[model samples]
Target: MNKSTYKNQIKIITNKNQKEIRIDKFLKNYIQNISRNQIQKWTTSGKILVNKNIVKKNYKIKPLDFVEIEISIPSVLDHLEYKNITAEKINLDILYEDEDVLVVNKPAGMVVHPGFGNETGTLIHGIKYHLTNSNLNNFNLYRCGLVHRLDKDTSGLLVFAKNEYSQKHLFQQFYSRTIQRKYIALIWGNLIEEKGTITGFIGRDPKNRKKMTILKQENQEFNKGKFSVTHYKVLERFKYLTYVSCNIKTGKTHQIRAHFKHLGHPLFHDSIYGGNRIFMKKKCSNQNIEFLNTCLKILQRQALHAISLSFIHPRNGKCHFLCPIPEDFKTVLENCRNMFLQ
Candidate 1:
């Protein structure tokens, strides 16, 4: 490949012609922070080859069979450094905390981390500020104490990285796709199904950086996002709305909202995808309009909440955690019910 087209290449050598090392395993030894899937992609795309022959990722290494591959990825150096991260002791609702982890109830309208247009006053920034000059700093900046994240508009439980060891292990759980995350949401339709799953490929819209699209051609570039899935159960159905409890199997940006919207339903009060007067009026009684107005006043963002989170502790080998619903969400539900009563 042209030097301008490819970044770096690696050649693999082995002792004897052996079915010993799976092609992907042989690759991990050489590449740091790279996954087996990447190697397989390289193989499929003609980037990784054995003895100058294109092979599947399962190809075993032979004594003199050479493996050549090219890969390009951004360096961690491109990420923000710890020193540059100033912590702020912003009002964090610490639901659970210990020597190893911290679970906090994050409110809506709060960015979990500074990204996009949001540059400061994020959860990470605040945690960094609070943990400054403490044992937490012993770890890296990107993971001072965060395992996963909720969207800026989605309120609920978030586990933070308190140290480096926990950070790595926790991240491993998320990457391995084993983390259990559940959300509660008020949606704009009367969903008849009690439980079901939504699956789609989610990627950023080239036309709008702020949005993601589920439909894209196979083998497309970065514009094509990852496979996302959400399993949802209708907890309660209001006149024109439904409350859904969702367990996210694959966490992607706006997975719940996007999936529901794809099926002709968006979350309540969702500005981007939600219908304004249409859905809002469906659930509202004559009096619901007044109550919804009050609910809207308290709800700064979307009507979604991460009410629960459970995962195995990466260290001690035990199951752990459930964060309660935020007061604002509870208030919305209560008020929504009260509106229906009227």
Candidate 2:
């Protein structure tokens, strides 16, 4: 409710054809990078108004309806005060940079942000150091303008805004699923179908807090998890493994891992989701087993990489970015092709 905390104000006038749409649904379609749950919460909290009156989530929007949304931006000072994270100098593979934004190729094994066990030497710390050391001025110091993140050990392109306005703009893109992300993953089994889609709710495992799991909506409590969808297309098939490209429609914690594990074909070498062991049983000589073990040693981590990312530039709304696969990932693919695909 604080006027000073408001970051952005959106105003919309519905067309004649938009009648009968729910207010929450209308807001979600009109605004980029906002979730329906978030819209409902805003509606409940009186942040959304129709013709100067607060509306409910299910209110049917009328033709020519006047809708206004006030978005509250979290304060950087509060974030800094609560977290004991500090900036440290580190190497970074910056792919692109501009006055308003930055695109970096985050290497595998590097944590994106600081956390309890990983309090330093993260991508955030590296970004902060890069910004402070460069000529860029008047940027948000906390979190160094990170709009989104990649899990540790998943290498790929990541975007960071240079200021608060760009941050909010980029965040909206992610929320509305306007940003395009594609990942290449080598999995344990030959997919029966060349292309498929996986749909399930993702939530933390009740028994193992360290891992994420696919939830059965009928068995779980209300609001226990978020709905997630992933589309995959097989690129190449080996004797016992398949190389597939995945495009996630929803960003959930370990969504791809959990969904693939649910499908019984976890990522190659993904120990957390049971991809580390050999899944297929076959009669093989000792030499063949040793060769397989050698391949596993070379491909040590999960055979997944964020190979592509595309999003509209917040400031100019023109520029797009795409990053190439890293050497390690390429090397693993080559090893798989030479050793198993042959």
Best by TM-score: 2
Mind giving the per-residue lDDT tens digits that candidate 2 earns over 165-261? 6766776666557788898998987789999999765678877887788877575531356667899999998767788999988778888888899
Q: After superposition, how far is residue 67 of candidate 2 from its true place, in Å?
A: 12
Which candidate leads in lDDT?
A: 2
Once fitted onto the true fold, the runs of candidate 1 whose alpha carbons sit more than 4 angstroms away are 1-37, 40-80, 133-145, 216-223, 280-291
Per-model TM-score versus the true fold: 0.73, 0.80
Model 2, runs deviating above 4 Å: 1-41, 44-84, 140-144, 282-288
Residue-level lDDT tens digits of model 1 in 301-339: 677898888876766675656677777778878776765
What C-alpha lDDT does candidate 2 achieve relative to the native structure? 0.76
Candidate 2's TM-score reads 0.80
Superposition TM-score, candidate 1 onto the true structure: 0.73
